[model samples]
Target: MRIATGDDPFVVEILPETPSTNAVLAQRARQGAPEGLVVVTEHQTAGRGRLDRTWETPLHSALTFSVLLRPPAEQVPAERWPWLPLLAGLAVTTALREEGYAAGVKWPNDVLVAGADGDRKVCGILVERIEAATGSTSGPGPAAVVGIGINTSLTAEELPVPTATSLAIESGGLVDRTAVLRHVLRVLFEHYADWVADSESLRPAYVRASATLGREVRAELPGGGTLVGTATAVDATGRLVVTTPQGDRVVGAGDVVHLRPAR
Candidate 1:
């Protein structure tokens, strides 16, 4: 597929290959890239996730991009940083639904779709912050990069897991990757602007699109332990509230797997 170009509002840069769109954009932001600068690459050699997990993508088969946003100084609280990924997931789901697929968010960042027997992950989001060089921080510095990856036309054979799916697979045919990417960006910008104005309104849409709440899930924590619980709710700051065997616990980060009730 040929890389297309347009004189859009945001500075959209398309490349054939990059180590990772997030890393590249972060570097540019450190050097003062303007807000809303979008970097997209056809292939990512060193794509990474939140915990440095490997993110592989086939050449020209998926949407691998990152958007840079520099919020005003001390405008957003550090605790609410997770909202970036949450909002991005919502945008992806909304874009897919507009393209005629049932899309839902698997808490924190993964975007899932209903497969034949269960839900399958179709997209992943990662948000990263750039610190200042002064060695002392009092407020927001440069910008934050929200990186997104969406499976557009990957066949079943190309999927990393049996339960994972692509837009093409879910929609019964090939999907236009460019169209999907453009729509997602548009939705993200609109919602992000509203969030900057007033983040409270995003809660309803996020809660409605979330798949973790009201489900039995096993959360894999960062330090080497697991918590099995029923996801009860998502707090205003976007943390998952899980009712566990011991008690109710708030999970800030984890891999959540939905469980099936015993017969």
Candidate 2:
């Protein structure tokens, strides 16, 4: 199906298959691809998620794509770059909720939608930074490849995990993949523009839509320790702030598991 691009900067390229959309975009970024270019594939042979995890889905059962972004460091400070993935999660969650699904963003990258069993993961986001090749200095400084995967038409039995879900499963029927893609991309681009203009303005809305905030959680740190606490907030620099028994701890990178409902 055709992805309509009426007066938008997005140039969508659809491939029947690929190793990974993010990988493709990263290569193009290193070669100086423009912002708003999107690469989509029906199946990912080597899909990747955060924490170097494998993310695979049956052919034609998911919406997988990556968008190239070249946010100028002057317009948006380098320090605020971490907000890209979080803003993306907010964009996806907002789009799904607007489509009539109960959606909220889980910290640092996953989108959760309420299901009969519980809040199951419906989408995953991964942002990768690619610096320009040596002596290139062609266009922008560095580029960011934002990869997003959404479970669209998979059946319950076909789900990758019991805690994962698809749009069709939640809606109890078929879904129009093209329409969903268009809606999500539009929202995502809007958020991207808003973020470039003023990153701080996006924080309140993101906090309100966060499913992890005020919830008891366990954060698995990158270097090997774990922290159990109440996820108080997502700080200005996009780190997860957990209020533990010892005190408040800031986590810059880690996997967060929701241990209890939001308080």
Candidate 3:
């Protein structure tokens, strides 16, 4: 029951249950909580993902947590902040790889593990930027709350969708949730540190760990539109670049579906 943070900058608060760790941490951030405040819950009644999708899982069967970060705008630059979710995906992918799973990022934030049928998502991430309130002691800067959910002990039948999976199913046995959580936090901290030093250095590593690159995809763009093409690269700004027949199009935000390769 002892969760080891090991002298990292993190201050972890483990709750028995909660509605959403992100919500809790965002509220705390607005109340002037320092960076590296982590909120973890054994059960999340209302977890969410990108595009406002809701996810629910059995109690104590997943890793549900959120990290509060207040990266200095002078050091990280506001424009470079879009890469936080992608960086988190890379960190999770690296951590799961060390656990003997073939994990890779599915652009923006989902982490997928290669399966016999295809790649199945084992983790999802959501990052939200909270603006500072007027006259708040937290300063005029913004804070980011990074929420992460990883399916650990769920069985095959318990998966939310056909394309979803759990570490237990992949490993054929129960995996230690605390160990997984520790490893992920360690890697995420290291990745975050490196990114603060050099943001561009993160791009190549993410591309290498990305399952979306070098594949055909359909991106459901915002405002009722779509773009289908081969996913080529993640540009300098962390947007997805796709090569369409008309020309190359860059997607800043959208629901991307990996399409089956054309014959």
Candidate 4:
């Protein structure tokens, strides 16, 4: 596909191959790259996920990119961090549906596409914060990078798991990667702007699109703790409100897997 120029406000940097788009963008941000600069690679040799897991993408067959944003210092609290992933997921889901693919947000950041037998993960998002220098008490960091990976043309054989799929596979035809990328960026920018304006209004849409709500789940916590619960909802701050066996708990960070409860 021909790369379009001057059509979007953001600066798009396309690379043939990168170790990791997220890592590259973070390095650039540390060196003072401006917000809205997007780094995209046709292939990622060492892509990374939230917990340092591997994210593999074949050359020129998927959307692999990272967007840089530096929100104001006052708004850099933990409560607002989840908005980055939420907005990114919303953008991708909207873009897929616009292209006539059935898609939804599997809680946290995975994009689930409806398959013939069941739902499969088609996209993933990872958001990371760039911290300030040591011992510097000057508020939050300078930048945050949100990385996104979407399976566009990969066949079932290329999928990492039987529960994973691609937009092309789901549609039974090739999809326009450029079109999907454009739509996702546009949607994300719009929602990010709205989030800056008023976060309250964006909560309902996220809740509606979230796949974890009302489902039983097993969350593997950061410190090797496990919580079995039913996802009640996501609070305004974007934390998962889970009703655990002990009681209700707000999970700030964890790997969540939806579970099928016993009959």
* lDDT per residue as tens, model 4, 84-167: 787788878877787887888877768998766877889988899886656756543667799999998998788888888888
User: TM-scores of the models, in the given order?
Assistant: 0.89, 0.94, 0.93, 0.88
Q: Write the per-residue lDDT of candidate 2 for residues 1-263, one digit (tens) a residue.
A: 33548898788989899999999889888887789889999898789987678867998999999999888888987888899989899999999999999999988768999766678999998999899898975666799999999999999989988889999999999988878888999999999898889878889999989988888887665556668889898889899888988999887754443333532
Q: On residues 63-141, what C-alpha lDDT tens digit does candidate 3 reach at each position?
A: 9999998888889889998999999999999999988999999887789999788999999999999888767674647
Candidate 3, residue 66: how far the Cα is off, in Å: 0.4
User: Which prediction has more favorable lDDT, 1 or 2?
Assistant: 2
Query: How well does candidate 4 match the true structure, expressed as C-alpha RMSD?
Result: 3.1
Candidate 4, overall lDDT? 0.79
Better of 1 and 4 by lDDT: 1
Model 3 spans > 4 angstroms off: 1-4, 137-140, 254-263
- Model-by-model lDDT, in order? 0.80, 0.86, 0.87, 0.79
TM-score of 3: 0.93
lDDT of 2 at 56: 76
Clashing pairs in 1: none
What clash count does candidate 4 reach? 0
Candidate ordering by TM-score (highest first): 2, 3, 1, 4
